[model samples]
Target: MNLNLRNAVISNVSGNTQAQLEDTIVDAIQSGEEKMLPGLGVLFEVIWQNADRKDKQEMLETLENGLKK
Candidate 1:
């Protein structure tokens, strides 16, 4: 089944810390949960919007590697 990525992401990620959320994202990806993948985009947008440049870059890289596996 297809999922609304942005909305689902926003809802699931409401209270988690960055590290916690990253772990969750990695887990989701490893499990081949397609519904959870797009939510990473939302997480990326949120972190990019709010984080310092260094943090954003680091997170983005980590996310990219996570998604690729």
Candidate 2:
């Protein structure tokens, strides 16, 4: 069977309120399961695509700092 993970992930979270979305992300992170990474990546992709230049820069800075630690 063919599966589209990114679309599936987006569909799963579609129409979620801010709090619901935040909880989903937090839960995924706290779970520390590799299976959740793709979903997180998809979410990040959506954010990155919509983010302004400043937001993208901040995200990159945060990621860089995180990797340096």
Candidate 3:
């Protein structure tokens, strides 16, 4: 079977409101389950794709800081 994770993830969350998305993200994180990683990665990919250069740099800096901890 040919599975497209990105498309699947996007379709799953497509119609969610801001609050819904926030709840989903928070719940996934608080669960701390490995199964949620792919969805989070897909969400981050969407964020990265839509971000401006400044925002991307800020994200990178945040990632760097996180890695330091």
Candidate 4:
């Protein structure tokens, strides 16, 4: 069977509110499970695709700072 993980992940959270989305992300991070990575990657892909140059730059900078910790 072929599974489109990105589509599946996006569909699962399609209409979630901001607080709900935050809870989903926070819960996944707190769980620290490998299975959650794909979903997070899908979410990040959506963010990256929609981000403006300035937003992308800020994200990269924030990610760089996060890596320094």
Candidate 5:
């Protein structure tokens, strides 16, 4: 449930395969059971931390722009 554990699990999932990631996400989402989505924020934080500065800036800008809509 912790971010570190979630990242570790995700990291062990091998390559950055989008399909596999999507499937995992779908499985997590479709559980139809009550559970915390705590890992999402941690995942975002990890992604932000690992992103290039320019990409991080662009992502923030995009998020800001999206919020205005």
Candidate 6:
């Protein structure tokens, strides 16, 4: 069985509108299921790749703050 999770996740959400994407993310997070982590990670990767330097720094800072608690 050869499965590419990243590609699969991307393809699943490829044509989603912004509102649909937001709903997917919120639903995933609220589900609190381990299986959703990889999908969230792929989404974060997409966001990180497209973010500017300041945005990346802010994201890192936010992650750092989140881990501190």
Better candidate number, 1 or 2, judged by lDDT: 2
| Per-residue error (Å), model 5, residue 45 | 1.4
Overlapping backbone residue pairs in candidate 3 total 0
Off by over 4 Å in 2: 1-3
Which candidate wins on TM-score? 4
Stretches of candidate 4 exceeding 4 Å from the true structure: 1-3
On lDDT, the stronger of 2 and 4 is 2
Alpha carbon lDDT of each predicted model: 0.78, 0.94, 0.92, 0.92, 0.70, 0.93
Q: Write the per-residue lDDT of candidate 6 for residues 1-69, one digit (tens) a residue.
A: 114888888899999999999999999999999999999998998899999999999999999999999
| Candidate 1 regions with alpha-carbon error over 4 angstroms | 1-5, 17-19, 56-69
Among residues 3 or more apart in sequence or in different chains, the pairs in candidate 3 whose N, CA or C atoms overlap within 3 Å are: none
TM-score preference between candidates 4 and 5, better one: 4
The candidate with the higher lDDT, 1 or 3, is 3
On the 0 to 100 scale, the lDDT of residue 24 in model 3 is: 89
Comparing 2 with 6 on lDDT, the higher-scoring candidate is 2
Q: Per-residue lDDT tens digits of candidate 2, residues 1-69?
A: 115998899899999999999999999999999999999999999999999999999999999999999
Tell me the tens digit of each residue's lDDT in model 3 across 1-69.
114888898899999999999998999999999989998999998999999999999999999999999
Instruction: Show model 6 residue runs off by greater than 4 Å.
Output: 1-3
Error of 3 at 21 (Å): 0.7
Q: Which candidate leads the pack in lDDT? A: 2
Query: What ranking of all candidate models by TM-score puts the best one first?
Result: 4, 2, 3, 6, 5, 1
How far residue 48's Cα lies from its native spot in candidate 1, in Å, is 0.7
